[model samples]
Each structure stands twice: as structure tokens, then as C-alpha cells.
Target: MYLPSFTLDEKLAVITGATKGIGRAIGRAIALAFAVAGADVVLISRTESDLSKVKSEVESFGSKAYTICSDIKDYAYIINELDRLIGARPIHIWVNNAGINIRSEALNVTEAEWSEIIDVNMKCSFFLAQAAAKRMKESGTGKIINVSSVGGHVALRTGVVYAMTKSAIIQMTKNLALEWGKYGINVNAIGPWYFPTALTEELLKDDQYVQEILYRTSLKRIGKLEELAGTAVFLASDASNYITGQTLFVDGGMTIYGF
Candidate 1:
């Protein structure tokens, strides 16, 4: 029996915001995927306690694991800490999933709220991608998978700032792919919609929220965290070596539907 070669064997992966939500789910799933394919993983987040628990999960998959605690919003911190970790070890895959969303309308948005949203989702993402691309370029190859949102490709009831940030991600992804494709670094994004996770856990349970989401989602249902794992594994592995500068929407076909 021949197994699919879609594994990330002998590779090293660095996952950001790995303590909770889509980040946590991705961390656990990617660790298992990489281990099954034979690779080691490094988990990053702000809490050592949370990191410990997550590390245990990854280790339970029978693969090696490392932990890093860094506030993604800290530019110097992100660069210094990540640089140290990747020292000597070649980074084969990078998942830029650390992010936050503010619920203020464009009119009510304060300077702080806007900065916080942009700092993590846009700024941190860009710099981390730059760092990873450097290491990848040295080897002439790597994968940068950014976790965007359905809000990114389409303006939802979310807010103007978030929508703007996400759309920026799609464009950033394309731009990175265009510039780095010749260098062998594939830049891509995954836009998730209505997933039941930490970030959306509160929002999903709201009756009004669910109604609005389902109305536009066409499928009339929210997404599951597990459902998104497969797509992440694909984009992070050799299976997607040829795919780049595109975003795969894991929405219930929401981006295409309109009232």
C-alpha cells in the first residue's frame, strides 16, 4: 500500500497565535499532520501556561515540539524572538495566523481600536512574512499561509476596519506571491467564515448574529474548526507547491451570495 506523499516530513514549522481559536486548532492539527508526515513544530503565543498545554498536545502526536512566548503586536519582540528560534534551523513553513478584530463601526472607531486591529492583523503579519521569506529565500523555497477571513473578501456586518484589513491580506498575499514566486516561496491565504472557535465562539451563539450569517452564507450553517484543518495541511505541505497568490474560501459560499 502506498501512502499519499502530501506529508511535511523532515520539515520545521512555526505557527503563530497558537494558544487559542483558529490558531490553537491550526497548531494542534498542523502538528499532527506534520508528525504523521514526519516533521517537528514550534508553537508561539503570549502565554507560557497555554503554550505548555498546547505543547503537550503536539507531543502526544509523537512528534517534537518547541514553545515560544511573544506578543505579536510587539514589532521588535516578534523580530528578536522569532529570529532567535529560527537560528541555525531552516524554517520550512510559516503560518501567519495571529490576529484580532474590533467591532466598532468605521464612524465609531477610535485611534486605539484601529491601531490594535492593524498592528496585529496587518503589521505583525507583514513583518513575520518578511522574516520567514528571508529564511525561505536563502534556501530558495518555503510556504507562507495567512489566515484571513470571509470578511476580508467580502464586507460583512463585521466592520469597515476589519474588512479593510482582511482585503489587505488578500492583496498582500498576492503581492508576496508575485514578488517571491521566483524565489520559490509560495504565498497564499485561507479565508474562513463562521467557524466555531474562540474568536467567533461568542458571536456564533448570538441569535441575531447567526441569522445574519446564515442568510448570506447560502449553506445556512456555520463552519466547524475541524473542517478547516484539511485545507491548512494542504497549503502547508508539498501538495500545494505549485499553488500560490490565491485565497481558498472555506466559507459556506458566502462570498458569492448576495440578497
Candidate 2:
């Protein structure tokens, strides 16, 4: 009930890559948190079916929900639709959590694989941050939270390219925050260690990988989706009013541990 002053109440938030995994969990947290604080939500992803599911979940709390099934890689389409979506009101919050990671060793990585990871993770992150900042500047207030990973801050056990892309996200979060902070937009990122979602279900179940993730983790375990969701909400809300240009690691001390 403290949202207008201490929370994100009455804010309209848009979340990308909300169909599954980290993105999906972040979207759910954003929607439910905002609903509890009194706000509306709009969910976006590539699948209409998944968007429908999110909408249903958001509506469960009696909050207004909107959905758009579009690919973030198609920036033009996103721009056009964003205009329609924010017709008369400014978008108060934007969470860019949509990304993909294709793992390969350095020598074996394909040209196409490199391009896809870079385009989706780096290119898309920059442009979307740019677009959202432009609109936020007009309103003179907004927040943009990027869902990064421990991969960005550390080398991944399986994918170097994915790690590189995430590293770029950390810098992107910093640089964008530098440029947009004066415009009244707070730019920040969440770097998670090991969290189970649709993306990591198979890998998380593997004994070898599970042991590896746990061994390096100070908590001696992988993270729960709900655990990271709180950090997302804090970044999106007024509680973090003075925080910006930083990556909050929800990594269970994984980042601090010496390999």
C-alpha cells in the first residue's frame, strides 16, 4: 500500500521475453508485485499462447493485464506497437529479460551462432534500452531493469559466447544508466547464478552440472526463481529510488567465490 511513494503502485510495467524461464519468472514477479501495490501490467513474448497464460495469471489478482506476442529481435515491429501501447500514457517500468544462449567452444562456434547470441543479447538490449529511455525522458521518470546472469559477470562452464554477451549486458546497464539517469530513468541489472526455469530445466537436472553449480555457490545450492523476483521488484519500485547504474548479483555468493 506504500507504492506510490515507496513502491511502484499505479505504474504501468512492460516485460519482454515473458513466456518462460528467467524472463517469465521476472514478469510474474513484476505483475504480482505491481498488482499488490496497485498497478497494471503488459506482457510480451513470441508466443500468443504463453502471453495468454501470463494474462490469465495476472488477472487472477484482479489487475488489468495486456499481452503482445512479438519477437524482440524484430525491433521495428516492437517500436510500432510500443507507440500504440503507450498512446496516451508513459510506460513507467520496462524489464528487458528476453535473451538466448547457444553454447559452443571457441574453435567450434559457428558464425551464425555468434551472430544470433550477439544480436539477441547485445544488440537488442541496447536498442530497447534506447527506445525506452526516449519515452521515459518525455515523462521525466521511469525504471529499466535488465535480467542478466552470473554468466555475464563470470565465464560460463558451457558457453563462452553466452558469457561474453552477458558481460556486455553489465556494461550496457552501466552506460545506459549514465546516459539516462539525468533523464529520470534508473537503469540497472540483475545477475543471477543458477536458477531453474524452462531454459535450464534439463541442465539443472544433470548431476554433473548441478554439482558444479553448487560447489562454487556459497549457499551450496541453486537459486529459486522466487528468490530473484524480489530483487527485480526492488529495482522496479521506489524502494530503490537512489540506486542506478549497477548490477545486483543474486548469485548466492557465486560471484564472490574464487574458482
Candidate 3:
């Protein structure tokens, strides 16, 4: 056949921060996409209620849905519980979509803020990926997707710590891809510019800020969740079987423009 298949049939996937903002959007989109492709999902979030809501939505697609209500920052607890929770099911895909950002000037950042952001964004991501890789190694095949940000590539006024972690993630993707390629694993990252999420809803309300953002973006519009989800699906499917160690920016041309 000339065309490659994007089907995720008979596979199982896991998504962290499966309940809010970008995480929720990507998680749900992936779950729905996987369902349509004939795969099941494991949704991870801090709130049981939110997990249940997404679980119901995923089940509507006629695929199995498992919910894990726990903090992603608690990587040890999560790594330990995953085996029990998943039982004999092998994870075919894992999305590190849980992230937090505190917008602040470099001069105003505090140690507590730095530590919290690092713990959640960087530390947990590494350990969790390590855990997921271990399970994926058994099957000798899997996809690991990291949710990075454009700030990781270009400097932004958002927060220095956040950028540092994202940059680390991009590098981490490359290193992991190199180390795991021999075992048939792929590691990649997605860097988004602006998407309408609870975190950015208020920020977008500022007309001047929106215009400033639009000025830098070639598309001159914020991204849709499905657009980002579509990218995730590509990376997760057989379409991306040969791709790894790359950060696909869903930034609407923001990275290429000059201020």
C-alpha cells in the first residue's frame, strides 16, 4: 500500500494532567482519536471527578477508560502504582502533558517558585519517562510525547524557570530518543505558541496583548486544541514510526518571526 496507517488499534495509552487546560485538550483529543483508531486509554489527573468526566467521554467512543487520580509530581508513587493499575496491559503511548507556569520577571523570581516549577515540570517528567520507558522496553515498542512550549526555543517574558525546564525537555527528548532507539522506542516533543486554555483565557482578553501576540504569529490567531491534538496523533501513530528526537512546534510561525 502507498499509504501508511495511522491506526492505534489494540494499543493502550496514558496521558498525564488529563483534566485541565492544554493537558485536558490533548488528553481528551488523544483519547478520542485513539478510541476511533480502536485503542484504549488511561487518564491521569489530580481530581477524581475530572478524571471521571473524561473517562465517560472516552468510553462514549467505545473504548476502555481507566482513571488515575494522583499528582504527577509524585513520580515515585505514580511509577509504583502504574504497574498495579495497568495490570498486564502494556502502554503503547505516554504523553507528558502536565505542566505549571508562574509568569514573573527574572528579577522577581523566588527560590520556592523555582523549586516548585522544576519539581513538577522537569524532575517528574524525567522520572516518569524513565518509568514509562521501562514498561515500554518490555514490548520493545512505544511512543513518548513531551508537551513543551515555544518559550523553550525562543526567549519569552513568561518566566525563566519555565523556559529552562522546557528547554531541558527538548534536549531530554533527543537524548532519550538516542538511548531508546535501539529498543524500538521513539521520543518526541511538541512546542506550542498560544492555545486557548483556562490559563490563557484571561491573558487573551487583553486586546493589546492579543495584538502583540498576533503580530508575531504568521497565522495571527491562537491555536485550536484539536490542531495540537492532531500533531500528537501523528507522533503516536505508525506515520511517525521513523521519527524521533524532534520538537514539532505548533506555534503558528511564531518561532520564525522577528520582533
lDDT of the candidates, in the order given: 0.82, 0.82, 0.88
Off by over 4 Å in 2: 1-6
TM-score for predicted model 1 compared with the true structure: 0.92
Clashing pairs in 3: none
lDDT of 2 by residue, 10-41 (tens): 78887888876556666566566666666678
Best by TM-score: 3
Candidate 3 — which residues are off by over 4 angstroms? none
Ten residues in sequence with the least summed lDDT for candidate 3: 21-30
Q: Rank the candidates by TM-score, best first.
A: 3, 2, 1
What's the distance in Å from true for residue 29, model 2?
4.1
TM-score of each: 0.92, 0.93, 0.96
lDDT of 3 by residue, 181-256 (tens): 9989999999999888767889999999999999999998999888888888889999999999999999999999
Error of 2 at 114 (Å): 0.7
